[model samples]
Target: MPPPFPSRAEIEADQLEQLRALVTELFPANAFYTRKLEDCGVTFDVASLADFSRRFPFTTKAELVADQAAHPPFGSNLTYPLAAYTRFHQTSGTTGAPLRWLDTPESWAWLRELWTRVFTAAGVTAADRVCFAFSFGPFLGFWMAFESAQQLGCLCLPTGGMSSAARLRLLLDNGVTTLCCTPTYALRLGEVAREEGLDLGRSRVRRILVAGEPGGSLPAVRARIESLWPDARVRDHHGMTEVGPVTYECPAQPGVLHVMESGHYAEVIAPATGQPVSPGETGELVLTPLGRVASPVLRYRTGDLVRPAAVRAACVCGTHELALAGGILGRTDDMVIVRGVNVHPAAVEEILRAAGGVAEYQVTVTTRGPLAELALAIEPAADAGDATALARKIGGALETALGLRIPVHTVAAGSLPRFELKARRWHRAGK
Candidate 1:
């Protein structure tokens, strides 16, 4: 039998003991951690959390990439020998090189538990039927999600090779009450449904659990999906292949995502200085997996920008843990500078969707001499006319939303690319 999910306080109290034990186990076994601990001159016997954090050096993707380059495949962070590991997966490599991640049986179970919380938060009960529309590849997309649903006693349906039309038919015919996919895929499915004259609102899917991108937290995106499926509930979740599922959105507070501080230690810090930032201030997200000892990442900088909210005592959700406002704002690398104003692509999408005239849009950024310029190619809605007027409206919205003057251009319908996976909406020239 699996252990029940403990409250935030219970988990935190338990974490102190686990942290000390983990330090002892990883310190001497893993060369990377051993060297990191020795450099800070800290021992596993340290009692204070502050002292422990102060001694350990922050981990970065660049460091991990370098280590992988130094040692092919699994890198040098393994506490157990290569034979001890049981599973292998890699990062999506959307931003850079794919990172190969390994897991022992115990660590894999740990991942199942992390996802279990996500399902529970989304109100996925044993009576529900869940369908995972994923490729089921090595990217850890829906493999764990499927397993976690089985563990939760829900009937799991895997739609890996089926086309979107077939998947839609299966979802309706099988009475799947829950869905798991990227936010982009969910919208894409909506588009397909409209073309097929299928009303998704009449389908059996009552809930949507979205990850893999920032679309879940964006209000316009969320609203658009909800508008299409009026009966379904869409919730945002945050996780990584490197770190297990770490944060989940509380249904009561849809705007914020609560970090599973019991399973991981989260820190918000100044990206350049590596120092802790003040509460409620935007900073880089650093995570340390407490349970994933097989391939543990200590203080791994996730390159996600977030503003940490102070723990509120009187909350509908009983967990007294760190919460990120508006979920993940954007990635540090995804920030676009247009006319000296920093803009997140998600923010731009919100403006376009809100304007109610954009069917699809693409943002292209390039260097013209020394200036960074942004050009938006928008596909107006079927009901929209006067493309230039709509373009000006989009430009005005961007200016008001981000305080940036971005040049918007209207393009022919179907001019922009349609994405089935993660949407590459922004392009940079001469990188």
Candidate 2:
């Protein structure tokens, strides 16, 4: 059985205790955080969460990258000797350079325990068989999730090297009840299933746990995936290799993601001002993982934008944990200015997915012009007829939604790249 949800007061008390313990453990030992905190005039003891937030500086990816470069290999973030760390994984290099993270056995266990909360929220049980449709690379994508699911006594199946068709077969053959993957790959599998005449709607999989992307929370994307697998519930989750598992979608709420306050303390701050945003306002997400002391990050800037809701007087899920209304809205770095308007790739994706008739699409930013322009190359679905007309319709939709005339061109079938992990469809024209 899954663990019961704790009240807001309980969560806050636990956070204070863990934050104090974390600070006590890191001072004078973890070189990276010690220098950072000391330079900011921070002491080993924090009176309150507010005091810690005010005194401690925000840690960024660039700082960590530079530290790793200067120190070589593992950097100075280690709380223990090099030999004390056992697990190794690196970032996906999606934003910039890949960050190498190390974890001791105890810290790794902390990670698995957090993942259990994710599974519990999704209603996954030991009797269910889970299939992870991932590359199983060194990027730390679904490796921890696979292990955590196994620890839950769920029959874990990994389709690391297998093709999409093979993975679909494995899920069906093994009677898998839960499917774990990114929202992008989940759509890819649905596409493949249609191409091969496989009926995924009738499969035994009842839960689709998606992370690494915001599509799972977007209405259009989630609608498309639900249409593909009518019987399964698409659950959105967000995490990072450095920060560990952060938020999971509430089964009771379709689009709301509750921060796993037991695992990490979360704060939303305005990107420009760096001050805490008001409830129901969109801002960047900052996280401080209470556990994982082997390599702790104090108030790490995650770069992902979100809108946080105030604690509910009466909650649907009966948990007072911080809720992000629309999951991850977009990335801070992913915002592009065109014609005096700020646009995110996620916004374009929502428009395209809602427009329909598009199977796969890629965005190319053209910087050679006076103003940066976005050109879209779309691969129409098999059933979408008259590519020329479909392109014009999509172009009008983009203009209507974004108030900018983005050029939409139809690409050959299967010409656009398909992602099995995090999708990098947005590109610069001359890059």
- Per-residue lDDT for 1-431 in model 2, tens only? 65466767788889999999998999788999888878877778989888878877899999999999999999999999999998999998988889999999999999999988899899999999999998888977578899999999998998889999999999988898999998988989999999999988669989899998889899999988988886898999889998999988887898899888898988899988889999888999999999989999988999999998865443588888898998999999998898888989899999999999899999998776556888999999988999999999999999999899989999999999999888999998753
Deviation from native of the Cα of residue 52 in model 1, angstroms = 1.9
Query: Relative to the true structure, how large is the alpha-carbon lDDT of every model?
Result: 0.83, 0.90
Error of 2 at 268 (Å): 0.6
lDDT per residue (tens digit) for residues 1-431 in model 1: 64354655666667777777777889689987787678777666757566666877888888888888888867899999999999888888888998999999999998899889888988999999999888888887567889999999999999988888888888988989998988878877877787787778679889989988888888888887777676888988989988989888976888688887778888888888999998879999998888999899988899898988865453477666688888988888888676778778777777777776777788888987767878888988666789999999999988888887778888898677876557888888855
* Top of the candidates by lDDT: 2
**What's the CA error at residue 249 for candidate 1, in Å?**
0.8
lDDT score of residue 359 within candidate 2: 91
Q: What is the lDDT of residue 96 in candidate 2?
A: 82
